[model samples]
Target: MNTTRTVRLGLPILLLAATAGLVAAPAAEARSLPTYTCGYTLDQPQFDSVRGRECTASAGAPLIGHHWITFQMRNSGSGETWVCNSVEAALVPYYLDNKIDPDYADFERAYGRGADASVCHRLLD
Candidate 1:
């Protein structure tokens, strides 16, 4: 051990193993769920009849208190079956009133094709 005292004790053990590998390196993933852009507002004369459908979901930001906003619907002749509704993200343009769906004349002809949205984050307590 003569090379300058082994290079000052291996340079402090190589800087403490490079700071313990950057503090165990592992942390980057926290976004429960939020990001939507649905569509479905067949302007049947703007809104006077024809089932007066409406479902233009949207959620780009603002939704961090347990999060909430899931508007889904699909009943074009009962394609299996799917109908959901949950708005709370400050409620921004979330309308899904397919004429109250009494099958509303098959959802007023083509009023139900696809209009999904999502932004939910409430993991326990």
Candidate 2:
């Protein structure tokens, strides 16, 4: 006598899938707050990094381009070299606005004297 045997594993598979759905999802990780510190470099790469130290909405301040320039003669007609600040904000012709640049009274006026004064003057050059 020839006979055919049928295996009915579909119910077991369905139960396994249903159990998987009942599992709780892994907890989501919290996003980290921005790292704040006094100016770490004479040349702050981005204007937002400067504002980051101030704890203000980035949009509230104008985004500007900048670079550091070491004044060979700052005070005493200066030292070997000293005084580095992101002074190029005044020189940047255009950015997102693509219009006239903000007429900063001076380099220190670009961000505000407080931030400009925080520039890291000494570093392992």
Pick by lDDT: which candidate is best?
1
lDDT of 2: 0.33
Provide the lowest-lDDT 10-residue window in model 1.
43-52
Considering only N, C-alpha and C atoms within 3 Å, which residue pairs clash in candidate 1? none
lDDT tens string, model 2, 1-125? Answer: 12222224566677788888777566689743211122222333353222221212122222244545422112212122224444333212233354365444343333432233234343233
lDDT of 1: 0.36
Please state the error at residue 82 of candidate 1 in Å: 12
- Cα deviation in Å at residue 86, candidate 1? 19
**TM-score of each candidate structure, all chains considered together:** 0.26, 0.21
Clashing residue pairs in all predictions, respectively, total 0, 1
What does candidate 2 score on TM? 0.21
Model 1 Cα lDDT, one tens digit per residue, 39-94: 33221333221111233223443321223444333223322222223332322233
Candidate 1 residues lying further than 4 Å off, grouped into runs, are 1-3, 19-26, 35-114, 117-125
